[model samples]
Target: MVVAEVPKLASAAEYFFKMGVEGKRFRPTVILLMASALNVNISKPAPEGVVDMFSTELRTRLQSIAEITEMIHVASLLHDDVLDDADTRRGIGSLNLVMGNKISVLAGDFLLSRACITLASLKNTEVVSLIATAVEHLVTGETMQMSSSAEQRRSMDYYLQKTYYKTASLISNSCKSIALLTGQTAEVAMLAYEYGKNLGLAFQLIDDVLDFTGTSSSLGKGSLSDIRHGIVTAPILYAMEEFPELQSVVDRGLDNPHNVDLALEYLGKSHGIQRTRELAAKHASLASAAIDSFPENNDEDVQRSRRALIELTHRVINRTK
Candidate 1:
């Protein structure tokens, strides 16, 4: 297999480094850093006896998987910006915006190559196969979304399934990778994977709610991309189901920017946004329940990660535009 070019970390890396660098968010940055560090190896102590009990071999496997997964994820974002023609992300200019789309797409491709190379190095054919499948699902999700137009936003089945592939599958894969590294039972891996899948659904629901509610200032992208792109996310899809009439506005042929605002209003009238949040919360609850399968000792960090993950999940819902 061809190797991917590693991203040049020179000047461009500085911008990513600056995130949460100042003021009150400094602590948030530290927490993010700590989590990143933990991905490689648990530092600082694992809360009482947790450290002594963790299998070092399993931890190493988890670290390698995480690093590979993260590189793939970051690369995908770069490519996604180009496809979406998105200018902003993570509250700043997108990679395409900064480096130009041609270079950005190359960078994304490079990251994917890097991830695959890392996957191959693991020497575990099962994991390499799983990662490859996950990447294919991601591409499928992107294609499905592209086919949507105001004329046809797709059905609830399509929407949820697309959401699973686009947003949740990678996370679920990450959990499964964890189990594989730990030499856990297949039942354990499947349970963790299912938990991740549910968590991802909740995560996407919150994202859909955010598009309407979050500020352009906070969210980076223009809040109405979902409607404009003809992609009906959970909130709007729920609206379409509840008030069938709203479908007309969503399906309005090649809706220009002029009508996007009006379409949003119609969706709002159906109370789809609120309903979406309720659904996301239900999924989050399921993810939390999945923690029962984890060993009692090492669970606190993972559980705290779950709680923080839940908080971020809710933030996606309440975000105001």
Candidate 2:
């Protein structure tokens, strides 16, 4: 659905979408699972020839929601590559590197426009409002990260809020949308949102950890890229607690060749990596507990879906790449 919307005049857009075909599709998968789990008759047999119009309509809406979610994600990635001047993405050259910045940014806008069209087609004002807010949060989060003062970069609370805006907003809102489409109560939808919110936080925190600990090949990007880009992530935030002198280096913008290496050395020696992992684990636990709090049900499908969500939290923290 995402690729088909790319204009033929802009072939580069198709290439960009193709590159993302093999992505985990994590956001959409979560939406579909949540839809099934929340369905009241998920475990019951359908009435003969009745067509289960409610189930059919729900499936169609959920699928569109998934496509819209992926489109938004890919659009963000395109814009990010331009902002970061990234050369590679997903182990291949980034679109901006090959097609230039103008095309990449325009393609991102094109994808976003298509996503909005899909969102409108869903015909649910509340869902449209939710996703539109996610897009706004994405821009605000990226702008905040880019424009943050040196002192703000060092603060953990600022970092976490930025993380929520950038990473959690899309998934959390989409999870709520799924619940809403399924006609779930407001309380249940909030639970789904909470689960997605914590999961996204944990996911981004672990990605920050891997930036320090994982190899470039494993991570599919340059190792230590965050600090090199002058972005202070979770690991660096924790390391500042141990080595106060590093603040000056960060304040200097990490432009000096030696500064990055020196900062990495300090981070390696400090308990920053351990502390970051602990923080990620704390969020993962919150994510698990969110799903666990769902009302008890004898249905095996519901239990299995709940367990998958819990396991996904574990994967978010433990993934090597």
In order, candidate lDDTs are: 0.65, 0.85
lDDT for predicted candidate 1 compared with the true structure: 0.65
Per-residue CA lDDT of candidate 2, range 176-272, in tens?
Answer: 9988887878998899999989999999999999998889998889988888888899888888899998888788878777888888888988999
Estimated TM-score per prediction? 0.80, 0.94
Clashes of 1: 9
TM-score of 1: 0.80
Mark the regions of model 2 whose C-alpha exceeds 4 Å error after superposition: 3-10, 40-48
Predicted model with the maximum TM-score: 2
Model 1 over residues 1-321: C-alpha lDDT tens digits? 223333453333323334521113322222232233223234434467666545554445555676666656666677788898987776677767887887777766766776787788778887787778778889999998887554446477788888888988877777676666656668866866776677778878887888778777665678766777766787777777777776666666425765566667667688788888898888877765665554454545555654564465455345453
